[model samples]
Target: MGTAQAATLAASLSRIVADPNDMVSLSDVLRQRQLIARMIEASQGEAPLQQVLNGAVHTAAQGCPAPMAKILEIDRTDDTLVLKSQCGMPAGAIGRTAGKAVEGNPAGEALKNAEPVIDIDVRRRPPESLPDILKDNNVVTSVSLPLINHDGPYGILEVDFPEPTQIGAFHISFLAVVAGVLADNIEKIHARAALIVERDAKAVLLREQQHRIRNNFQLIIAMVQRSVLQTTDDGCRKNLRDIERRVFAMASLYDHLLGLSVQAERADLGRYLSAMAASFDDFYALRTSGIALKIELQFGIDVDLDTCTTVGTIVNELVANSVEHAFGGSEGQITVSMTREADDLCAVTISDNGHGLPAAALESTGLRTVRLMLNGIGGRLDVQTAPERGVKWSILFSDTPPRKRGAAKP
Candidate 1:
């Protein structure tokens, strides 16, 4: 503004302040406009969208001389202007949705023409018309301004007063500028949040891919070790080979989990357990020798991903041990069953009908792995072994104790 214009605005403000009863002078109006322009510049840099919208609603209603005001956003689903934030309306009338267009309502007219509608009585209009709550709140006249965005009409901003004659041109101008600022802020916030979500999802996928590569590397190590030991005549070397293979198989299963995406605090127990047991088959050529391993699953909803990995690792270790020691230098059958028990617990049992576990094997490293997995899932392990008969190892996990789901028990 020029110096002359600034001087004129100051003079007008002085006149209005001196005579409160008289209509505001041009200079007073210009001063209000200048203040609004300053506020706009101050708000330009950065602010949260919700904060801007709510602040604008409060500013237009309380900071201005106007009696009441609101920022309305269109609900695209319903094609109606719904109040997003408001001040000065009765609490019950704060969030009412304006009726559909038929004729004569200020909001409907503004919406239809994508322009401002000033000095209109909104009580009588189309289908269901104005809500009774608004009428009860003593709103006699309203001005509605459509909030336009890149996609076209977003919503409307409505200001209310006890009578139409009480509203001034300055008040309406200031509200229009405020509405634009609010719309821009909303768009910025929405775009930023969407970008964050997209980035996080991609990061998760990449991590899973890395895990699968690690598992493949472990499998290669186990295969090489098995190949070297199989050509040896020493019984001690064969035993060492079996131990190495089992450890490598365990590590491979952990790697396989990277490729698996378990949704929100829940894991696919069936797939996880199946994947772990299947890893052993990949390491040992048990299938070619007719020693078939079968899996039976009956996991319940409360069994999350953490529980699955723990239980899966335990099952893998037990089955591998059985194949190594119990088969009597020949092929044998292995059965794995999981079923939910009474009292919010899940039980997994691995059984084989071959040479049973001796007392000395109870404290073995393989059994320790089974016990650790069971404890991690808030459960315990019970081993039933009879010499020359068979062995049954059962794991029981309960929901009462909240334990980390995927970590193996110590």
Candidate 2:
């Protein structure tokens, strides 16, 4: 390649990763290959040659004029260039590997010499290393660039040119640059994919454990509830009801944990909130007198387990306290609104138009439990009264960064 073409290729190679599509001009590929080769020769310690090869090839075709370009990882053990990944190739041709190395075929020559090979008249099947099936179907000109890693030859890039006449020294040089980039990028992609797979596998195991834990919790709660009911003493009955309250609190937490799928990396915050609110509604309907309640929510915000459980418990305590103390002798309304703040804090406000917070709530054990839960997540709770009206609890809670779950795990 000429100095200008070489310079362009070299510059682009360094910038391959920054490009959104990871492509480069034809001239750019040539310069990159030369530069990379020098870097490989000069470097002594650990170097990322494989990644360089893949990135080079990927960038070479980024904005290419041709319809297809690809990087194939050569498994010398099998004597074939396996198509690891590519851009602009027909889906039917994906995963297909080029035929084994041959002495005279353009691709084979390039691989054998550890260099670039350009075949202008690829339309006619080359005497050697040509797949008969491809030649019969009118296969044409192709340029093959070999990818050499520190370990050995990693892959090859094959660019199918529309016309045999378009192949030239500039094209060959540019393609070489592309080859080095492909080597590097291919390695990175493979490593990243492997990490993702491992993470997904771990998440699946965690979810399965969560499922079993939830089931066992329900079973134990059932047995406890039954045992409590079998007793007739009023004192014992009261104690069981308190036990049932705590168990239900935990049960609600288990319900959310179990609802997560084996593949999920994080809980669905919106769903958990909706379900928790619904549970509050049901609990009131079943336990209280004629007090009717209403709930409204704005969703799509996510939170971690610690924060979610604390929030749920706080809501349980507040709603139950409202229904128990505020309604006096008639019906009332309860409104819940929660939103995520820009600073990653969750803001919650619950309001009811019954008797305001009892003078004793600030000193009550249940209130203390609620306070402790809020404090655990770096949140604060406050009770307010609307002139001669009911009670409202304004709360602020902080949560851990949202984690991915199942298919959502990136």
Candidate 3:
């Protein structure tokens, strides 16, 4: 590969806990890599930001071979640098506001250039902040590496030496890699905090929105019920009653939702449908006398809100079909079941053991509604009916998106 291509590859590899830049010897590079690998394995994943900062500072002190190492966080609120972690110095000095982190000093120069700035023999050029500590400890050289990434500057990592010395390529590389790792972790911590705040805010708004939605649904049901009572036309009354039942089916879903699902609006499918089924039984208790409504629903099956509503509508329609038309004003049994047939398949079956239905009943408005709702949710229905035999309707749909579609991992 060309030099540009090789450099690009090396830069990408450096992000994986290893930096191959400015290596003076094979041993130096290997030691740097090994120390970084250990540091990452110890501090990765959900570690507190303070703990991570301490780990990075200690690792820098060890690998850079500095007598003292301290990390300062950029306090943008006051345009100051605050000591976060320190090793081989007074531990009580932590949390002290160290310096004005502007573009005048060696530390500020590193932050401004997004690189390392080295100053040796500090007797000639002493730093403004932390002067007493450096003088008492006879510190001579100070190397400052900016803790920065694509999100911009976070802080600075400073490694100071007691004796006058020229820091080598390996030490600078090690400090740079440590600063990069620390900066990345800092970014992740900030992003996670932001998301938590956003989620909490959304949850509050979501609860209020849900309450308003529930109230609206109840108002619609009540209005439909009032219309049912006022209308004298039998056909118009039946249609209005159907509307009331449909609205009730949607409203009653909130009752069976037990706990939180993977998604905010998701719920246990079987429990949700079972609750709706119980409500339906109660709604048609007079017509349902002497008839057994058996529900066999599978728990833990989850789907989105749209799928839940659409499938619930389809299930409600099919169950209503068997409850009203399958029996000739007599008594029988109705079985409603939902099951998971495969990793990505779901089936809902509603069957009834009653006198057979005429072909004209299958072509009624209820079946049309069932078909339409099923189509809306990417599902299909199959029916089996004959004279003296019962009626069975199975609705099948995939629980997962098609392979050709893009999907994110849960």
Candidate 4:
């Protein structure tokens, strides 16, 4: 053959070797002799994996002139060949089995030897040796090809004729090639499915680890709270209480991260703030000294874990500062609001209806800690204060793009 003709023949054979679906057009007997040399040169290429094996069987059957064609997968659990796909076969024959023994039936025989088994005249064979499905369908001649991959035998492909007819060696060889391609594609698809299953298993394991870590933090916070209750010195007790609240804030952040449906790289800012506010309210409620305190929280954005942690610390410091210094041994109210201003910007306002901060209060260690926390999240803090009027702290920061409005609520 000319170089150009040889190349075209090689490409066609490669397509046939890679995909059983391409075999329907490859069974032309007149072209077989001329293409045999090119077929030998065709390299095995990767076939696109299919979700279902029945489609491969149906495609292969379309090329044959036989009266019936079917594919049966080996059921290793029971050592039976269960029919998976079929064309021109009885409805009840689709899922029928070829029994437990591999000696009698053509499908079982082909799978046992990893080769083709041809019965040209089934009537001449012993009646017990014939498959019930085939005998009932009046099949006279049948050819079964084992579908074998690198992993060994998996299934069998069978074609049946109503009348006894001679099948050439070339035709049987072509069918074997089709079976090999189909088996290869099935193996690749099975491998991919196994990988996905393994990945999901690992994700479950990681989530369990995160849950344990959150539980450990809760235990630590409980121990700290017990320490606070045991202290006799008023100053020491107050310091220990502050330590417990800080640890609680860290614990709450972890709880939110673990509860998220997606990866825990970010958190719902509104939800986290609300949770922190609730924790503080519960802690301070027990120290009732006729100080009626009301805390209002409104949130409208989400932030990454780093930003969430920094903002959470800032809130912890600022809110605690307000509770200790804003109310001068009297009843007061604190309102915390978070709103998304734009795609990448958000503002948080924490205000109180109590005695406002003096100029010296801004220079305190608590306010300095809040400033440092804001800086870490690439945020700016602004304080509006006046004596006896009250104090409002406004913090504006860059945030992730806003989620759909009704998607998450605080």
Taken over the whole model, the C-alpha lDDT of each candidate is 0.64, 0.62, 0.72, 0.69
lDDT ranking of the models: 3, 4, 1, 2
lDDT of 4 by residue, 62-148 (tens): 545577888888888888888777878767666788654378777788778666777898778677877788877888998887776
**Residue 94, candidate 1: alpha-carbon lDDT:** 48
Cα-based TM-score, every candidate: 0.52, 0.61, 0.72, 0.72
lDDT score of residue 133 within candidate 1: 39
Q: What is candidate 2's lDDT per residue for 236-350, written digit by digit as tens?
A: 8656656655656667777877766555445555567677777765655734666655666657666777667767767766776777677776777887777777566667778
lDDT minimum window of 10 residues, candidate 2: 401-410
lDDT of 3: 0.72
lDDT of 1: 0.64
Clashes of each: 5, 42, 0, 0
The residue-by-residue lDDT of candidate 3 on 261-371, one tens digit each, is 313655667877888887766777834477788889998887766678777877776677677677877888889899998887799898988777788887777777677
Could you tell me the lDDT of residue 135 within candidate 4? 78
Higher-TM-score candidate among 2 and 3? 3
| Candidate number achieving the greatest lDDT relative to the actual structure | 3
Off by over 4 Å in 3: 1-23, 33-55, 86-141, 148-154, 162-165, 168-170, 188-196, 254-267, 285-292, 303-306, 322-333, 341-345, 353-356, 375-378, 384-390, 402-410
